[model samples]
Target: MGDYTDKVKTKMEDLIENEKNQWIDLALKIHENPELSFEEHKATQWLTEPLEQAGFRVKRHLLPELPTSFFAEWTGTKAGPTIAFIAEYDALAELGHACGHNIIGTSAVSAAVSLKKALDDDLPGKLVVIGTPAEEEGGGKILLVENGWFDDIDAVMMFHPRDKTMIFRGSLACVDVDITFMGKAAHAAANPDQGISALDAMLHSFLAIKQLLPSLPASANVHGIIRKGGDATNIIPDHCEASFLMRAKTREELHSIKRRVYDAVRHSTKAIGASCTMEEGLIYAERINNRVLGYQLMYNLERIGVEVDSSEITTGIGSSDIGNVSQLVPTIHPYIKIGNAITHTPAFTEATKSPEGMAGLIQAAKALALTAFDLFQSPSLIMQAKEELRQTINQRRNRL
Candidate 1:
């Protein structure tokens, strides 16, 4: 077993060195050309082209309904334990790869490619690379999972870029909603009393939420924007729309908070004599990290000289599509730090493309590939992971 582990390590090291330039170039290309969620045509092509060229049978699952979203798979000759690597290529709106999705695409692809190269000699499992889209808004992984995309996979793994490297305990709750208020439009000056202002309803909703903040838990968050307001200045606007994102520590807590939010909106609109309509957008559950798999990743990372402090286990609150994936299967989404800059900002964008970012990319690829290798090689670890997931599912069912 030790000999086999060493062989895999040697193979990964060699593959990293050999494919360094290719991976870096891929990252830069994706970074240079950013595409928004479900609109990543060029980015998807760039990601899958290299894999297709490397003799992997590339299959695309196109939802004609969803043009920008796709699924790519590569099956190995021998199938023991199916290991999956997930890739995200969709960038933020107008920000390009500011969230460092280019690095994410590159790192996942590199891990899959490296694993493929290692398994060429004696294949023990099937390697699947799934291209998930619209992680920023639509919870693309949740959609894919609901469509039965991750049924047979034994385990799922993906790494994200952050300001530090650590195994996170869990993620926060996320809920997206769209609210619209409808009122009668009339002349603002001549018939001010005859018109009901939708803008006033929105303002009242905001104020009501602000007043409710003291009642909300520390972990809960309520933030939003008025996407649409009155069009004309002299006339009262008939319709106004707003979007909100509410987050909390648990799914139940988020639901509770959502109910209050709905009541607030309803009452606010009612106070202004306007009708209100609310539509639920996307609801992402908190991530429950598989502790056994997370520890295995930490072990593999340590073997590769990546020092992750135990104190770094508890990270900040953020939501991800991978959180949705975690509920369906045993998964790990470890964050690897490239620099001290926070994500979703210009500084993060600049740091993500810098030399330090490239180096972190390689290190992240190495860690992910090695972790996959460990899962492939150790049946005990695989059983441990499966058992952990089974217990979690059972516990949730029992509580229900």
Candidate 2:
């Protein structure tokens, strides 16, 4: 926007450009060896090695409970805001980096290093790259937020690789439920009267859920798979289990849907002479984008010759652990266009390692670094973003 901002942004561009190949190589290494959620030991090591080597204070296994999660901090000479870039490296099961998380994780680290290098360590705030694993299966960032990992962060930023480029896309609130049904087992023909079939109870629950979905809001959904319907058709099943992933527009709506679904499950279990237990994983809150930060990122992307689609998306939304982090602090999870391939697909996996994907990675790193520079240069921006977050939280509470 001004001479000083332009000068600093130029430095960042040069720094990130000079080492683009290294970042791409790092991302490709992670993509080649995909790791599942909470089991990203190699990805974690590869992502953090550069930070550790760059003189940043790197902490491995940040929380003992989360083995793959780590934190790297670079503080300036003067006191100011703490801007954090979130890195999600966990790949989908069997899909292997279809979501382009290798790009997300690498871009965060590259941005932090370039920003620090561009400033020559004479900046006015702290730069942090948080290695948050398990966005695929487990809510690693949600757990980190619960454990006070994001308590002092003034702002959070991350870029996702998608078919489209968007700055203010919203995500649904979600949670996973593990349903277990227990009943007495007996031979199908030999002791038919003595058998209490858990499989029947599970089937009844599924039917009830299917019937209930039609009555619920279009934004609310309950889908699941029967993990163990029965060991054999000849025997009455004593134990059965199912896993369902539920989603809603907001946490309040999600809670209501959960209540109805759980009621149906219990009612179905009772009708079939079986007992059931429902274990819920972490509840991922809906994302609340800070307009102030979002605008800064959008402006940075535009300045760097990257196009950002600022349109509103009301449907085809998926949930993320970043949603939970957004509830706690001001956060931005914008998307950078890598290719026209849908995520979580084999085509998307190939796109993550494509030349276009590498270009997107460099663009993401520069935008993130530039945005952080702007915040450090102007303390008032941090205050404005935080105020917006406060208002957003209050509005959500009032709605609930």
Best by lDDT: 2
lDDT of each: 0.82, 0.92
Q: What digit string (tens of lDDT, one per residue) describes model 1 on residues 1-400?
A: 4887898788887898788999999999989888888888887888888777665556665555346555555665666788887888888776667788888888888887787777774657777778888888678887787778888888888888888888755788788889989999999999999999999999899899989988987788999998999999998988999999999876767988999989998999999999888899767888878887889889878877887844434346788878777887789988888889988888888877899899888888888888888887876787898888889878866764
lDDT of 2 at 387: 94
**Residue 356 lDDT (model 1):** 83
> How high is the lDDT of residue 41 in model 2?
95
Angstrom error of the Cα, residue 49, model 1: value is 2.2
| Residue-by-residue lDDT tens digits, candidate 2, 92-172 | 888999999999999999999888888987889889999998898878898899999999999999999999889999999
TM-score, predicted candidate 2 vs. hidden true structure: 0.96
Q: Cα lDDT for residue 297, model 2?
A: 94
